[model samples]
Target: MEQLFTLAGIAIGSSGLSAIVVAILNHHWAKKKNSSGKLDALVEAQKVLMIDRVRYLGSSYIHDGEIALEDKENLAEMYQAYKALGGNGHLSTVMAEVERLPVAEKR
Candidate 1:
């Protein structure tokens, strides 16, 4: 009975040690995985929004020149898409955060 208890304690200690090592390794891996350029999706999305802002100015009366009605229509579609994506105002904070992320890295 004494020998059996010793063996069981050794097994439990090894199991705890193994679990700790695996947890440390997983945290390291996760940190690296999130560092990829995955965040570019958001950056590119922001870039697209900035361009549409310009288009909005050009198409609406803001430019003082009447953009072709077709151009105006296209601008509307862009605006709608922008709105669907939480809109320019909603992304203001997100854009700031995205800008902080390394342009070469992901979120």
Candidate 2:
């Protein structure tokens, strides 16, 4: 009877050990999946913002050259585009021209 009880205890202990190991593995797998999804989202957002900054910087340069600042609606459109695209990049010191632009003409 004593031997039977000892064998049962060993079996239970091994099962518990396996359960703990499996739980740890599952936790690591979940974290890896979540981080992968976040990384993909960040990359996509960066791509969009890069495009916007490049486009705005080009248009702003042209407008600055072709006469006095005409209508700021163009600049406003650019600012919002910048915000959507991620807004991190900036143009050359020349692009300081963006601030000179107003929200819109008084109409």
Candidate 3:
């Protein structure tokens, strides 16, 4: 009877430990998932901001009918980043237009 009680105690202890481990793993997974979601949101927001800046710069250059070499370089960098962040082809068209513009001479 004593051995039976010992075995029961061990079984109970093992079950409790298993439950605790499962709980900890679940909590860790939930935290990681939440962090991933936040990161995705941040990336999407950054992509939008990049798109806006690219459009603004591209439009400015296109409207002016010329882009300074420095401005063109900067715009190219911005457009590259925007494209890296999954920006659409519409901006590609705008960038092409900007690319065709004459380079302005520095005063």
Each candidate's TM vs. the true structure?
0.44, 0.46, 0.90
Model 2, residue 84: displacement in angstroms?
21
- TM-score ranking from best candidate downward: 3, 2, 1
Q: What are the RMSD figures for all models against the true structure?
A: 13.0, 5.6, 1.4
- Per-residue lDDT of candidate 1, residues 16-100 (tens digit): 9999999999999998777655675686676586555745454344334344455445555655567665555643443333323
Best by the lDDT measure: 3
Best by TM-score: 3
lDDT of 2 by residue, 1-107 (tens): 99999999999999999999999999999999999999979867776765566556657555655323444445446555655656554543324555554444233
What lDDT does candidate 2 reach at residue 94?
28
lDDT of 1 at 34: 79
Against the reference, the lDDT scores of all candidates come to 0.58, 0.63, 0.90
Off by over 4 Å in 1: 6-14, 17-29, 32-52, 59-61, 88-107
Between candidates 1 and 2, the lDDT winner = 2
- Give the Å error, residue 59, model 3: 0.7
Residue 9 of model 2, lDDT score = 97
Query: What's the number of clashes in each of the models?
Result: 2, 1, 0
Count of clashes in candidate 2: 1
Question: After superposing candidate 3, which stretches have Cα over 4 Å from the reference?
Answer: none
